[model samples]
Target: MSDGVRLNKRVAEDVPCSRSEAEAYILGGWVSVDGVVVEEPGARVGHDRRIALLPGATAMPIAPVTIVVHKPAGVEVSAALIDPAQQEGKQRFLKHHLHKLELVAPLEKSASGLVVFTQDYRVLRKFREDAPEQEIIVEVAGTISEGGLQQLNQGMKVSWQNETRLRFATKIATPGLIDRLCRDVGLRVLAQKRIRIGRLPMSSLPPARWRYLTPVERF
Candidate 1:
């Protein structure tokens, strides 16, 4: 017999469920080895060790939830953890299930709209790994010359923070591009907000309010 195996694999082999379900049970504090609770799925279990599923252990897999918050300007995404009141939702479900939340693609303090928080690792991984483009609407009060407009559309290299960087006029806007537009393009930006991430739009999510992402919603 092997000296040790991953906890999830051992649970999957002994229990009538997949490895993912086993992991969920473990994370939910349902699995114990020699009377000690082991929460990590990757925890090693000796072959000779006694592994037991607690009486209240759930056999079903828990689906991860993703929350879409219409974050108002000046509110930090990280503030949600310190003050759940910052999350603008009257739903009781939001109160009970807000623990272990992870923020994704946080907006700057000066900007507003569509901040995402999730318990799903897959969603977090997708955003981090993909570095998907975003859509932003910037309200500026300045005239652009015909030549400047053409140059914006064609993309330009601007000096930013003592370094040169490429700025594009496509729907996607990054902090660097926004800074270059105000400093180099000679535009006075009055407001800027992100409206879309990937194909997901802020849509009708009221300012400072939030809602759970529906099953049909992806990223």
Candidate 2:
């Protein structure tokens, strides 16, 4: 029943931050209109109204939490695992653990690797395809061609043979075929960690521990 645009939308249009960042600010209680904190990003406000971040709020808008979970096979990313009915129309998945943080993203159940959980959606936004800083590193263990890795590293133009696979530093990878690559390379895939989202390397932190993203960590 509201007539104004959403706070995230307004922030995206006016500030350098993405819509996700604006939402994060609202969720973290950093967003204020004329000085009053507003919890709802959908709240209506004038297009010309002034919005500000609480002093020092940007130091770390999200609480200190980041989990590196080794998702077991066969679990769906929905909100419900056993019975979808219990979730009231929400699908069940591993993301359920971070429900308290209000983060939303579908995880691939069949894949077992690194799963990151955080209240910080802005950090997540960096993984979007359009984000300039985004880069994905998935280990491929297969009998790749002599130049296969090199081809991927060069990012050859997508063709029928390549299909959706994109070239990484020295390998071709798609979002869904890591398992096959592992089989081909004879690697058992003991584990696959999502090592990087944008320039943030997973190696920087210990597994299963959550930490507040430093200002330098913000892409």
Candidate 3:
């Protein structure tokens, strides 16, 4: 430790800003060492490495993050959501983001797609008090008749994309509700995936990879 100074201390002295501000600069991806961006404020440097902020960089407050992970079939939601390798997004990774995350709208191990884990209390409260009002869009593969489709859409809605895909929209169904509903209608389900929950869609996120749910994004 005596051989080098903490990067935050170096940056703080150079920028003439507070120690906390320097930490913010590093966490915000504004600080670099030898022309390479380094996010760790506690990184040790021996006075040899060139360190500077990017052009017009600002040390803005780092907000709590929400992650939207595309869970793969047969993978447990808890395991998949927290894995470091599964994270894929532009958001800066902070160690704290992995703690105190409230997992929402859990899917079964047999099912897959669009699982959310968040540290934001507002997002948690929304799911807590208004979950029943949220419309869930599930894409499934099965067979059903015109009459059965009519029956399936009696209180909700359903769309037929092809012989291999049928989309169902519902208001907060249980983990196995779709399977049970399809079974009741004589439809044999081959596969099922929840593509959307409330207004958030899975979009192009590949399986097992996750992206940040930005400040503007809501469940």
Q: Tell me the whole-model lDDT of each prediction, alpha carbons only.
A: 0.67, 0.47, 0.77
User: Candidates 2 and 3: which is better by lDDT?
Assistant: 3
lDDT of 3 by residue, 31-126 (tens): 888888888788898788788999977877877778888888888779336666767776657665776877877887778877888888888888
Q: All candidates' TM-scores? A: 0.57, 0.36, 0.67
Q: Tens-digit lDDT track for model 2 on 12-77?
A: 676658788887767776778777777577888787678887776552444544333333445544
Candidate 2 CA-lDDT value:
0.47
**Over 4 Å off in model 2, which ranges?**
1-114, 118-121, 132-142, 154-175, 180-190
Candidate 1 TM-score, C-alpha based: 0.57
Error of 2 at 90 (Å): 32
lDDT of 3 at 44: 90
lDDT at 88 for candidate 2? 22
lDDT tens string, model 1, 99-201? 6788777777777877778888888888878755666666666654446544555443322221222222243355455746564555665656777777788
Sort by TM-score, best first.
3, 1, 2
lDDT of model number 3:
0.77
